[model samples]
Target: MDVTQVLRMKGGDGDYSYFNNSLLPRKVISMTKPIIEDALTNLYCDMNFPKTLIMADLGCSSGPNTLFVASELVKSIDKIRLELGNYDEPPEIQMYLNDLPNNDFNTIFHLVPNFQEKLKKQTTPNSSSPRCYISGVPGSFYSRLFLRKSIHFVYSSYSLMWLSQVPEMISTNKGNIYMSRTSPPSVIKAYQEQFQRDFTTFLKCRADEIVRGGRMVLTILGRQSDDPCSKECCYVWDLLATSLNDMVVEGLIEEEKVDSFNIPQYTPSPKEVSTEVEKEGSFMIDCVEVSKVNWDASTDHNVILFEEEVQGYNMGKCMRAVAEPLVLSHFGESVIEEVFERYTNNIKISMSKEKTELVNVTVSMTRNR
Candidate 1:
């Protein structure tokens, strides 16, 4: 799949919209608040407390959570400025909310006014009111999106896991959309090579944009174990492949079609990420942490339970929100609902045996001169 064109979270405010079903990313944002605040403080000190701060949130999708990191960064920077007696002449925060070209930029543009107003009210009147200029940048993060030595602090959550494109010449991983336990060593190597090339380019692009000593905080789905095919990273795709195979048996979709459909995504281990950072020679890894988030991480207790169908349904929504667009483009949208319905049932059966979750690897880094 061409990720730049097809990979986008479910858009708009509909029932299956990403805005409605993105509690997982929201929880991730909340959990990483302290990291963001700390990074902002250090970035301020690194920049020598400049009068203007340039920040960007890469892969920022449309939703309440889109501006979440930017909002927190604003508060943290403003607080620091106030404590340092610079409130009366606080820095201007130029925040760029970036996502794919097909993303719902209008939703974010419409919300900019409200976000600016909210930030204004959070600070005192005489405190120079840290001016926030929020704009939507539509492009792929794998390439250069900003000028050299431009941005100071970069934050991205649940985004870097998406590969720029699927690896070439992988004819062995039939009937599977992603890396699975049964995938051959060649398939695993293809994914690893793709991630390395893409991530290296990612670091190079950011290195040119960020100033020396600039900091970056990224959170993406990954595996704790060194094995790339571990269940924590690939089981969901395994179950998804199972559902699609069932459809093939029932003549809903052709077998060859399933064989050719591979998702352009990968979850790198901490070692993989650190190795890339070290090899890229532009950034130093500050911290790499792994956290488990249940499939249904929403606040509603009913949504987290697997005994009933509610949990499965919620989980289905979560997956559909991110996968529907790509699946629809390939499957013609006819079997979309049915595929998810079956996928949900599979999840219910699996979760009953054990608490299944995805591992999020959060890595904090700083640009090195």
Candidate 2:
């Protein structure tokens, strides 16, 4: 396969959605849902929504957290339905859940019944009669997935940053690619270019999918506007890189490959996205707030289980999300364990250093009416 194609394999292994679930405390989740609902409310005009208005989670992975998003949607739907007091005619809320083909649908399917039940309880006769119709649409977000103007809202959590592939330059230089994430700047630059292209296309696609009055709330990684030094500024990448270095010193991996690696250019500032949203003339800025989404999975208090799951074996999984295609060569598969632990520990240290720092940013906006 081409180098770019290989790089996409990086995301298949350790999805952030899978881990973010355990990390977010109940109180934090409680606070976050309102912000999302408020955005959706503004977009849909206070849940005076359609009888068959559609809401799609663009990158709905196979994790329990998917329901958290679903529940949030239902919360707004129910609240609005009660206020509207149309017991005879409730709006039809169709929930379209999507993700990459490789995502675990078995897990996703298992959650559907419970998700439906929860909505049913919150939804009175005044809510949409058919209730929220939940279904899975498995495909790439880069392409069109819905019928024309058939959608009212779209939400993609932590998914837009994945590029279609590694750069062709890396594909052409596969044999000589860096093993270290920080080993070379050229590889990093190539990946960043791909991210920009991918993001532009994503905005365009979403712009097309939603009606002029429709809205989309996209949550992805971002850097501070003032962080002039883009290189290695991300806490996640820094932690991962340091871990990889320890593995290299222990003779677990080749130094050149580890040094050449870097995080994908997924994290963009609010200003950057706001510029594109306006440039496309597709969406108007409803809210563009930046805050850290990083949460510490306490291994010290929770047990070794949290530690092991975060990085012990999943470090490479996280790295491959952006590194696999960028680094064509390999340094034996056996050393991956050591690589994983160091990778996870670095994150642990970083998280420990800052308990309430703003790390994850979500920018919510609406299609121009």
Candidate 3:
């Protein structure tokens, strides 16, 4: 599916009522705070030199969560300022909030004014007005976006797996993954290729965009290990497929429509990601860890907690948040509600706080000077 169609299909006014707003930037920021903070601290000597450094949050979703990263960033930089007693030369940060063009900029941009207000109350001793500038840039992260050697700290959460285009192999007869029970070797290869392509370019672009000592902290869905062929591969792809399958069998959707669709493989093993980074040869990996994301607090009594937890964002984000339009293309709006119900039930059955976890990994690396 193209970007515009995707935005509309997954639009708040559209048929995707189950996408769940939880996937918005707010959750991501909450989810990724610790990692981002640690990286910023390490990069800027605990953010002491914020005015001199450049920090950018790329592919940031639209919502309050988007502010989470910037807030952590400014605070970290401020902490650094206090320690150095150079409160006068506070950090100058350029915050870039990115997303698909259809992402609600009104909501994302609103974060800036809120941030300015928050900073006003907590101004440091040496602080003059912070050189903190936030601008909304809409585009695919896979292509060129940043200035060469300009970024000091680059952070992205749950956003790198998308490629500029769908894998070509999926559209061909040789495509084994879309037709097979599990991800076929060909499909896996195709996705692996796409990831490598996207990742290498990402590193290269960052290498160009970041200064010599610049660092980046990126967290993306990753496999528990390097094995990509496993059935319990990636939650986004496999579970989403399973969800769609339920809809197909129930006659709510067409089988042919799904036969060719492919989920951009979001889950990669640490080794797989490292291999790609190594290919770029510009960044040195500092950390790669897979941790559980506690997104679902729902137990038997989901009553208010589930709704409260979900109410912050649109429900359309729940069922098809990651790939709503693609799934919709196969199932259509007629089966929207049922798809989300099945999607939720299947997840409840398959996932739990104790056993199954939202598998993701964080990679922190500094650019080669």
Candidate 4:
């Protein structure tokens, strides 16, 4: 199956939608706020505070989080302008929100009026605010999405770990939907090579579009261990595979169906990311930092645990929001609820024994002259 054609977060603001379950991503954005603000400040000062600033949020999936990012950008720049006493002439801002065509752009568009009104209220009475123009650009970021040297800054969060497609050799990966401890050496090698190729293509495309000295900040799902199958990186998928296997044992789904499924996602190490950036040679790495967030970080810790079920259920809902579309496309709709049900139970058992965390890698870079 072509991943680009089918891959997208579950849309709309419904209970199971990514729009509602994206607290984890919102946490990621908050964790990286200092990095983002630093990058924007450097760009503003380095460009001598240009009267017009052009930026884009790549893979900006729909919801409040979508405009939440835009709002952050506007506020950061406004703070810089306020510090510099440039209230009389705030720069005009052109912000592009890009995602796959399958993403719910309509939901985002409907929220723009409210976003603008909030910005208006936030502006001080006598101070001028940046006149911001927001537009949606629907397409894959792996390909060229902007004019040459036209963009000033770029940001993406909780995206980029997804490959353009599953590796051609991945069909040999049986009994697993992602890299796991049991995956053969060949399967692991194929995933690594695919990420190298895809990440390089991404850098080359962006190098051509971002002007010299323009900056990009990316927060990707990543692992700290050099071992690709480390528990922190692959345990979630292992639990998911076990869930499918249980259904297979019950004859609810064919064994071959589970054998054929694999996610088009890879979590690279910091070394892997820096290696690609150095090889691509278009951008200077300002910094690469790793952070760990608990699977239940968004949930209330005050909740009394009835045998630790809440954390598992919350994680199950979060994973479902992110993975349901891909799973639905592959297995059809009938098994969605049952599979996640089993998956949630497996998580409850595992979380009882140990805490599970997601490792995120945040990279800040600037285009070389």
Best by TM-score: 4
Per-residue CA lDDT of model 3 for 1-369, tens digit only, reads: 553335321433333421234443344456666776666667777434555666777767655557767777878777755665665656677788777776666766655787888877777654664557788877766666778877788888777755655666744422232323454567667767877887888787778888887789888866675566554455434555677766667876677766666654446778888888888899988787776644442221334455432432233245355455665664577776676676665555554323444566788888876
Error of 4 at 22 (Å): 0.7
- After superposition, the stretches of candidate 4 with alpha carbons farther than 4 Å from their true spots are 300-307
Report the poorest 10 consecutive residues by lDDT, candidate 3.
171-180
Task: Residues 195-242, candidate 4: write the lDDT tens digits.
Answer: 999999999999999999999999999999999889888988899999
- TM-scores of the candidates in the order shown: 0.95, 0.76, 0.82, 0.96
- Model 3: lDDT equals 0.63
**What does candidate 1's lDDT look like per residue over 74-111, in tens digits?**
88898877766664578888999999999998877887
Candidate 3 lDDT for residue 150: 77
lDDT, residue 328, model 3: 63
List clashing residue pairs in candidate 1: none
lDDT, residue 340, candidate 1? 86
The Cα RMSD of model 3 versus the native structure comes to 4.3
Sort all candidates by TM-score, best to worst. 4, 1, 3, 2
User: In terms of lDDT, which candidate is strongest?
Assistant: 4
RMSD (Cα, Å) of candidate 2?
5.2
lDDT of each: 0.85, 0.59, 0.63, 0.89
